[model samples]
Target: MTRVVLALDSFKGSITASAAAEAVRDGWLSQRAGDDVVLRPMADGGEGTLDAFAAAIAGARRRPVTVTGPDDAATDAAWLLLPDGTGVVELSSTSGIEVLGGQLRPWDAGTVGFGEAIAAALAGGAQRLVLGIGSSASTDGGVGALTALGARFADADGAPVAPGLRGVASAASVDLAGLRALPPGGALVLSDVSNPLCGPRGAAAVFGPQKGLDAAGVVAADAALARLAALVADAAGPAHPGPATPGAGAAGGTGFALLAWGAALVPGSAEVAELIGLDAAVAGADLVITGEGSYDDQSAAGKVPAFVAQAAAAAGVATALVAGRIAADADVSAFTAARSLTDLAGSAEASLADPARWLRAAGTALSRTV
Candidate 1:
């Protein structure tokens, strides 16, 4: 009987993280009866972040508030209040691209609502803040968020501009006087990306297309971000280490904003794992399995599975991965082995429509070797 820990991210468009974990458990149990298993669903500060954190802290309160969406629409979003008084804010709940429906434009999205949510959590007496910066639809470099928090981004005319990366280019001044001072302990922003806010390989070039930006849009967005960066440097003195670090381009440069506002940039998966006590869970496990929807060259660039694999490796535990699909001949050195659910299920549509069946099958196959 092997003690196994199943930690998987959401399959995206197919299954939730919890369902994916359960599928693995059921599949593994079918092969090895009474095997010790622990299920820990995971996220990279993106779509499933709130759910994963809520599940980790069972029965937590999800407080809803109105925030600006990707299309500048008033939309509902939530923040979690745990029993321990730590407030968890997932930006996607407010400014996610998925909430846009058919209207997807990075130039128009904003992070103002995210700042409002933070303020709401503070008013509710939250002592610590854990902000997850992923799955955003804005490229304002967090200018909109700051505006929501009382920091103003004004044009040369001294009038406020609409939120999004487009506003960044015209930004000539920033006012931070109105921001509510953080409590004595301050806040911690948990970002999943390391890309800088500006430059060729920065936010716009890497993430603009994902938000429906064309080549021209990318170029414009990049220029806008460069202008915003210059403004930040003028205001804050210099670009911080974590903001300019790799993976900081996440959530359309929200990571840069966090750094500017004095948030620490720990590894997103590592921070989540620490919060959920994954090290303790791994110590008692014989094998650990983790994965996401896709595995490719980018997985090495701070994706969830790679983080889990690193943690498992640190614990001297063997790890395996099961994704919906694996990039052809991708580097799997991060895990002991890797497999694709699509390979066993025969087709992507079949696998997505009936993920439970395929996940179980894939788990069973991996269990034989583990």
Candidate 2:
């Protein structure tokens, strides 16, 4: 009997990692009842990051808080507190584009909700913070989040600025005087993107289009991010984070703003994997399965699948993937075998409408082969 590990990333917009792992385990059991199976839910600093932490940490509890959302509406958000005094907060839960549904507002969306949740965690005696800044809807240069922590963003008239490009463009000064101090263990900002805060490869230019910004809006957002960076550095003095730092452009400059608060940017997959004990699980497994919604070239770039494959490889174990859609040009050579639910279901729409059905089929196929 094979000792298999189900370490799958959440199929965004469909099944989560926890659900996918269950289906995979069930299907594998159907094929080989005696096979040993280990479930390890995975994420790459995106939507399901908090779930991953909750699965890994003992005594992790959800702390609920109400705050203003990206759409400028009151909403409820939850931050996680680990047994070791670590706070887990995902920006997507509070200020993500999904919160607004199909109505995308790049210029006006902000991350104040995320900050409020973090502040709540701090108030509860969190000694450290693990912030997941992916899938955020805002490009406010993180002024909104910083503002919630008591950093002030003012215009030329000394009046407080609005969120997003409006605030960054008309900003003349900033004040970090009343901002909350970092926890004893500081902060770890998770992001896989290496883009700088402002430039051609920056947040607005590269990611703004997806956030519903036009060319002019992208240009404006970039300049605004630059202005925010300069103003922050001027006020913060020597601890200023350089603009060229990797991941400064993440979540619309939220990564850069976190740096201003003296946080370190780390690779999301590696950090999460360490927390979830991926290496230990893979060590004794005969095979490991990992996947995502789309297993493409981007997945190879430090996403959960590639990271899991690397860890399994180091342990002399084989890794396989079961993805929602597999691009023809995707380099999935790292996997011992790759299966696509879309390919099995005959169409993307059909596969997405019911991902678990095909995901189970893929697991059975892998169980027989692996």
Predicted model with the maximum TM-score: 2
Alpha carbon lDDT of each predicted model:
0.80, 0.87
lDDT of 2: 0.87
Q: Which residue pairs show backbone clashes in model 2?
A: none
For 1-370, candidate 1 gives per-residue lDDT tens digits of 7899998888865788889999988998998888998988888877788898887777699988887777777888889998878888888778776777647876778888888888889888888888888778878888888777777789999989767876887888876657667655667776666677767768888878878889998898888777776676567565455446665577888887766676666667877787688888988888999988877766766778888888888889999999999988678977777879888888887887898899899889988876
Off by over 4 Å in 1: 238-243
Model 2: per-residue Cα lDDT over 1-370, one tens digit each: 7799999988876889999999889888998999899998988777899999988777999988888899999988889999889998888888887788768888789999888888988998999999998878888888889999989989999999988767778889999988999999999988857778989878898778878999999988898888888999998887777777888988888888899888899989888888888899999999999998888755665578888999999999999999999988899888899999999889999988988888888888888887
Supply candidate 2's per-residue lDDT for 57.
79
TM-score of each: 0.91, 0.92
- Candidate 1 residue 83 C-alpha distance from true site, Å: 3.0
Q: Work out candidate 1's RMSD over C-alphas.
A: 2.3
